[model samples]
Target: MEELILTIVKPLVDYPEDVKILVNEDEGRITYQLSVHKEDMGKVIGKQGRVAKSIRTVVYAAAGSTQQKKVFLEIID
Candidate 1:
């Protein structure tokens, strides 16, 4: 899951090497934490958050057929 997230998100940022992702399972939900260079934050989020929304959508879809749980994405500084 972390690899999938990285594969999809790394290209959008300025510092691909600085991109980091962490996943945690608590109860029945999964939370994904994405950390990247400060300069690349806006690019990852995009205007009006559309880019972020798209990313989450892709992650949700990719997680399909595995578990019937919720997925969450967070950008951590």
Candidate 2:
């Protein structure tokens, strides 16, 4: 899931080289923390959080399909 998100978002940011993704899995859920260069934060999270929402949706779907689990994307600084 993290890889999918990374693949989609890395190219869109100003610092693709600085993009990082961390994934954690619990009993039934998974969370991904995505970090990017500070300068690219605004670009990753577009108007009204639309981009964030889209990323989350993709993570959710990927997890559901691959692991039958619920997944969340946490865009961290």
Candidate 3:
């Protein structure tokens, strides 16, 4: 899961080395907190959050239905 996120986001940022993801798993949910370089935040999020939404969509779809827990992606500074 981390690899998937890295693959998707690394290319979009100016500071690829600053990209990081923290995973939190609970009884019924999984959250991926993604943090990127401050300057790259706008690029990852894009205009009106369209890019962020699209990234989340791809991630959720990739997570699939086999998992019992719901998956979530959160972008942070």
Query: Which candidate number maximizes lDDT?
Result: 3
RMSD of each: 1.1, 1.1, 0.9
- Please state the error at residue 1 of candidate 3 in Å: 1.3
Stretches off by above 4 angstroms in model 1 are none
Model 2: lowest-lDDT 10 consecutive positions: 61-70
Tens digits of per-residue lDDT, candidate 3, 1-77, equal: 78989999999999999999999999999999999999999999999999999999889988875567899999987
Per-residue alpha-carbon lDDT of candidate 2 for residues 19-77, written as tens digits (9 for 90 to 100): 99888989887778899999999989999999988888877876777876677788899
Better of 1 and 3 by TM-score: 3
Q: What is the lDDT of candidate 3?
A: 0.92
TM-score leaderboard ranking: 3, 1, 2
User: Model 3 clash tally?
Assistant: 0
* Ten contiguous residues minimizing lDDT sum, candidate 3: 60-69
Worst 10 residues of 1 by lDDT: 62-71
Sort every candidate by lDDT, greatest first: 3, 1, 2
What TM-score goes with each of the models?
0.91, 0.90, 0.95
RMSD of 1: 1.1
lDDT of 1 by residue, 11-68 (tens): 8987999999888989989999999999999999999999989998888888776667
